[model samples]
Target: MVLAMRHGAHLIWVGLLLCCMVDMGATMEFTGAEGQWARFPMWNACCESEMSFNMKTKSSHGLLVYFDDEGFCDFLELLIHNGKLSLRFSIFCAEPATVLTNTAVNDSQWHAVTIWRNFKNTTLMVDNEVKWVEVKSKRRDMTVFSHLFLGGIPPELRSVALRLTSAVVKDHVPFTGWITDIKVNNTESALLNSAGVINDLCGAAANMCLNGGVCNVINDEPTCDCSQTDYQGKDCSEGKISGFSFGPLSVLLTISNSSPLTKQQHDMIIYRFPSFQAVLVVQQFTENADILFL
Candidate 1:
């Protein structure tokens, strides 16, 4: 009985170590440099399909993911444009459908991104905020002949007229950030087929965060928390803003005072800012009633 108990405890320890290893190996950081990319097997987004991933970045513009039929028939692209996540896709050579999120994800924080497609309808979710659009194309299925490209595309496929069908896809900058646990159809995991991609944001010898910023290992990647630091930005190297940090309260007040929010708009903001933990007491005086935040 004693021997059996000891063996059981040993097995549990081994299982825990394996789980940690799997977690550490899951994240991949993109350098955002030219010719830096990862290629995964093509995602069959024809008809009903889904793709989801976690991403962290500070770049305002970069191509997060792209796949299509050698740029000929149909294509889909997820990118960061103007600090917001944008999803663009086309079916049967029709005008592409674009769904862009209002909440920005380029704040160097881990954000869950999901894309769901059903026939012509496509939905994009960033954290709890959601936006969707329907394609006007007559065809329902999207044909993709190329492998799914993440971070960027191969330099050889850069030509717009000859190679890629979508001209706009080539113009977006390459992604420079960390992406992990990419799932297609909610089952298949995307594995990187490229070299030079770092497994962790901060490797053994170097710390990416600067200016006394706290470096935390989240999802096996080094993340800089600039909240308590004098400096801000992705690596905590940027100059600090000259004001009190009121957290989400200040943002809510600014938006409430700027214009009247529709129910849909108010709901979206509420999803993004679910709590006002920083402020002691907060009130919003609108035409209808006063909403308190605490």
Candidate 2:
């Protein structure tokens, strides 16, 4: 009877682990690479609609969202420029209206972005800050025939002028960051097709950085800097190290582990320990792991 109860408990633990892993796959990571993009079903913002999403990045410039009518009539674009959010849209091809936010969102922190459109009047809100803009064109409604594009536009449509009504968007940099919890008109679920985007967690949440370590985005990748903390590792969850001495020659420290170090982590270690020729550390959880120093 005791053995059967233990087996049942183990099965329950495994089931919970699998559930947690699936939940972590909701967030999407945009590589910011050229032509990297995600497409969603056409957004019906003709007269009145609302769109909201959570985003985090360290890029000063990148196209966050774009949609249009194949270069014929109307379009809308939300982009990050100079660490600020800018919204531009056109109706009936008249002079495009622009609404720029004073709040900077390129600080590598998660921000809630909301866009509310009611005919000619539009409201853009980032967290608590809000801005408004109104179109001057006679037509109040926006015509968007193309599928909504996030992160960037399709590579094939770059050269096609007619396909992309907004010429400036074609030249805009692609977004490299994390976007999740996207909703249209308060609806949370939507069919999303993506390219060059990872549908997994990459330090998207503040909790990803353990031991009070701060998370920063560099080159579109999330990295944890453990300089201030005693722990030294990618997420700052490893055992603490005390002291180090610089010898006449370089030193190599290797630990047998599981996961390999990321490029950013590797560079960080090199910069922190310049005297050491190289540090090869394999990250894993083992009681009898071997550490070699040469």
lDDT of 1 by residue, 1-294 (tens): 999999999999999997874485368788776666677888888888889888999999999988888857688899899999999988887888888899889899989889887878889999999999988898887787888888888767885456786777777778988988788987746454543355544455256777666554444445676666667777877654334335543432322222345766543234344554554667777685455455
CA lDDT of each candidate?
Answer: 0.74, 0.78
- Residue 237, model 2: lDDT of 76
Clashing residue pairs, candidate 1?
A: 71-165
Q: Which stretches of candidate 2 lie over 4 Å from their true place?
A: 1-25, 201-294
Which 10-residue window of candidate 2 scores lowest in summed lDDT?
A: 266-275
Most accurate candidate by lDDT: 2
